[model samples]
Target: MRVERLVPLALPRGQKLQCELCRGPAGLRCGACCVTYYCEVEHQKADWDSIHEKICQLLIPLRTPLPFYNSDKERNHGLEQQLSREKHLVELTHRVAQKFLFEGKHKEAIPAALHSLRFSIHIYGLNSVELVPPYLILAEASIGLGHLTQAEEYLSQAQWTVLKTSHCSDAIQSKLHRNLGLLYAAKGNFEESLYHLANDIYFASCAFGTNNISSSGGYYHMANVFFRQNKMDIADSLYSEATDIWHSYFSGLIDVQLQTIMSPSEIDILCLPALRFHSMELNTIFIPSADESQQAEASQILNAILDIREHASRQQPMKTGKVVHALAMLHYLILDIPKAHELAMKALLIISYLQKQDSAEAIQQLINLIKSKPFYAK
Candidate 1:
């Protein structure tokens, strides 16, 4: 719930504020853009040659009044073309915002995103779907910067806008609820957090059933609420569901991790894996059984599944590590020590990598679970 501070530029190691020029320090402000920054004036000036020149060009519209864009059909045509060209510029702003978010530069991201959103609105119009993400981004940035009331207000506006026409996409809804849940949870409003989380979970479940990444995210956050409540049984169940969904969701997307820029329904998705790993230390692992013959048969089938999973993990689009993790858990439950060890190690590697690189709570949870391997330690 506590949003960490943004890392400074020129720092040895940190999150979003890395200097673009040196990739060490945080940005301060560009005299031209008046928004982007550098560790120092020198870096800002040096970067002007490569990055800042283009960014300055992108800022041209922002500097001009809104009336110019609407100056007439011919001018509008030129403005429209210019806006189209700057589409990528907006993307760059979002990327910069992401770095800020990662480095706990939440405050910076809000303003940066605000600037970009304003430009986006001028180009795409306020009602355009393009504006939705920036609104959501600012809302989340507000949450990170401990501006919960502002966060809620921004999110509410975005939700109303999206729902005005069609129900917002499951992805957006999942995020909306997830953001609300995080804000409420941070405020110690567990009941409100739970309410939003529950809705998120339901949506995530539907998404999961249909193999939708958004819905699976819902289940993940749902598990978190349960975990916080110390309802281990329910939490574990939801965790299992979430792990499976994450595995499935990311199965086809290699090295493309689900970012921790979470929504209301997604905290649990990220947290559930971590919780499950914690639960493993209690010596309460479950294994399916029928008979000796059936166990062997099931183990054979599991091996086949494991092979498919491994193959998938190797491919670019299908990162099957989660599948490997679940399989490893199942292998352990079935008392297949060798298989469990292998798959567990594989899962541990993937989860560890994700945690290290992305700082996802779910992966961290899995790593903790691996570290507390009482059964395997001996």
Candidate 2:
């Protein structure tokens, strides 16, 4: 019933030991395992609580050097061990990178993504189609961190690999296009972004059904582009489609959870979907002039997202803060100054706790907006 451990250590030769959490130079090591290093006791305890406890013993096998082989039989055994280790290392590191990226922890994802890319090259060689997934992960993490040039480099590598392969799967094509779309969008090339996003939608629909949740991301990103362009009607329709896809998926999950007595850990699985739905629904609320009925519906959906987050075990502060900040924006738009200010302050506290200085700017701006009102001046 326990969650599986993932790859944690992938140190380079001649490099000094680094903290498992922050990647800073380290003098401390886990006493029990003595394999993983940390910059300080605090980071050590944090890593232990986050992942090391699950992976401590597992690190021993990965860290131990392979034996020298004398006979042919011994050589074959060593080769087999090497292959096994590389495969495990690539798969686990790739998954860990994906998990961090999904949680919006871009900085945290980079090390795991780099580790995955290294081991993937060891397993499948540099230009193999199998390397595409790790390249895509690195590209995504780079995009999230605003390193567009680095992301473009990784995406170009992926594109080259796909071109070299005789037959690439629709799934990989879909992901490649999605990242391309994201990169172009970040670069403010909306035309190119939309073209790539359209291809992303097509490939995703071809691989998974049109109604599949996997295809919803393309729709969501496309909506964001239209929304930014002030094309409210088109944005609203696209947002609706994305929201419906997520709503249907989460509705099923909520039903299952309601039927069974799920532990806190089990309930944690719903957090990501809830956050995704919250984002789409929040966008829908921004499509300008809404009737009272529409406003009521938006409130209901936002409250449901909060309820799901409330029950989750992890309580992801970064994501939760964004949700609260969005609600503050919604209240401000509706001219509910008091409610907006209260929620904005609450979101600021959460953002500050996570030490996200950039994220707090929007919340501070919202507070400034609330204070600038003529009614408040009196």
The estimated TM-scores of all candidates read 0.49, 0.56
- Predicted structure 1: clash tally: 24
* Model 1 weakest 10-residue run by lDDT: 252-261
Evaluated with TM-score, which candidate comes out highest? 2
Candidate 2 on 237-280: residue-level lDDT in tens? 67656656654543343334233433455344334443333332
lDDT, candidate 2, at 300: 45
lDDT of 1 at 370: 39
Q: What lDDT does the true structure give each of the candidates?
A: 0.56, 0.69
- Candidate 1 positional error at 208, Å: 8.5
Show how many residue pairs clash in every candidate, following the order shown: 24, 0
Clashes counted in candidate 2 amount to 0
Worst 10 residues of 2 by lDDT: 278-287
- lDDT of model 1, residue 233: 66
Tell me the tens digit of each residue's lDDT in model 1 across 328-378.
545554545566667666665765655545423433434343334445542
